[model samples]
Target: MIEMINIGLPDAIAYRIEGKITEKEMKTVLAIFRKKIKKNEKLIIYQEVVSIGGVEFNAMIEKWKFFLAFGLSHFSRIAVVTHKKWIHKLVDLEGKLFKSIEMRGFSKEEKDQAIEFLS
Candidate 1:
């Protein structure tokens, strides 16, 4: 499941992910992102992924493609909070593939720092 917390800022979109992420959840997130992109020239995304166990591999692959299609044109910054070290390494290594977006991964303890960076 994904829960969105609107920070009431034009430049920020915060989301907390738990349990399983379905196609519906991905659609909702993408919809909100599209709207935010239209309204703001640049957006900062703060995503906290608590667990990846509940997510299906196929669903994740589909979501990955969706994000790849979306690209980095709309967002300026992306802060990801995850406990998985492999995820952090992946983000660090592949983040350069995105042109405009600056992606950063953080541990749970660095959540505050991530938020601060995005803000």
Candidate 2:
């Protein structure tokens, strides 16, 4: 599941994620990104990932569509707050794939730092 977190900034996109992500959920997220892009909103995403098992098969397709539509490079910065080491490493590794966006992983205890970093 994904939910928007309001950090008192229109362009600052913060979301909380839990359990398995479904295709329907991804579709909604993709739509949100599209709308933001249309409005010329430069985005910075802060994701709180917890107990992420896996995304549904159809969700992968939606993800690919998003990657194609936006190249996953629309965001200028991305901060991931998580307790999972693997999740942190995965995001950091994926950051290399997109040069336009800066990706950083912050421990759960360092959420304030993450917000500061993104700002």
Candidate 3:
């Protein structure tokens, strides 16, 4: 599941993900991303990934591609809050691939810092 939290900032879009992430959730996120991109060429994304156990591999692959394509071009920065070490490492490696956007991984306790970074 994916839930959006509006911060009332033109460049800020925050989301929390839990349980399984279906195609529907991906589509919803993509729709919001499109709207944000239309409004501002560059934005900031704050994502909290709580769990990935219920998510399917294929779905994740597709969603990852979509994120890389759209997010790389439209977002200036991405702050990911996760307790999972693997996710942190993965995001760190992926961040190296994007030139325009910088990605940072933070622990759950660093949520405030993450938000500040996006702001």
lDDT of 3: 0.81
Each candidate's lDDT (Cα)?
A: 0.80, 0.84, 0.81
Window of ten residues with lowest summed lDDT in model 3: 5-14
Provide the lDDT at 80 for model 1: 89
TM-score of each: 0.79, 0.90, 0.81
Question: Which number leads on TM-score?
Answer: 2
Give the clashing pairs for model 3: none
Ranking by lDDT: 2, 3, 1
Model 3 ranges with Cα > 4 A deviation:
6-10, 56-71
Of 2 and 3, the candidate ahead on TM-score is 2
Model 3 C-alpha lDDT per residue in residues 81-112, reported as the tens digit of each score: 99999999988988997757889999999988
Q: Could you give the C-alpha RMSD of every candidate to the true structure, in order shown? A: 2.7, 1.5, 2.7
Candidate 3: C-alpha RMSD after superposition: 2.7
lDDT tens digits, residue span 1-119, model 1:
88897644557778988888877777787777778777766778988888764866666776788678766677788888999898799878767777567899999999888888887
lDDT of model 3 at position 85? 95
Model 1: CA > 4 A from native: 6-10, 54-70
Off by over 4 Å in 2: none
Error of 3 at 86 (Å): 0.9
Give the CA lDDT, 0 to 100, for residue 1 in model 2. Answer: 81
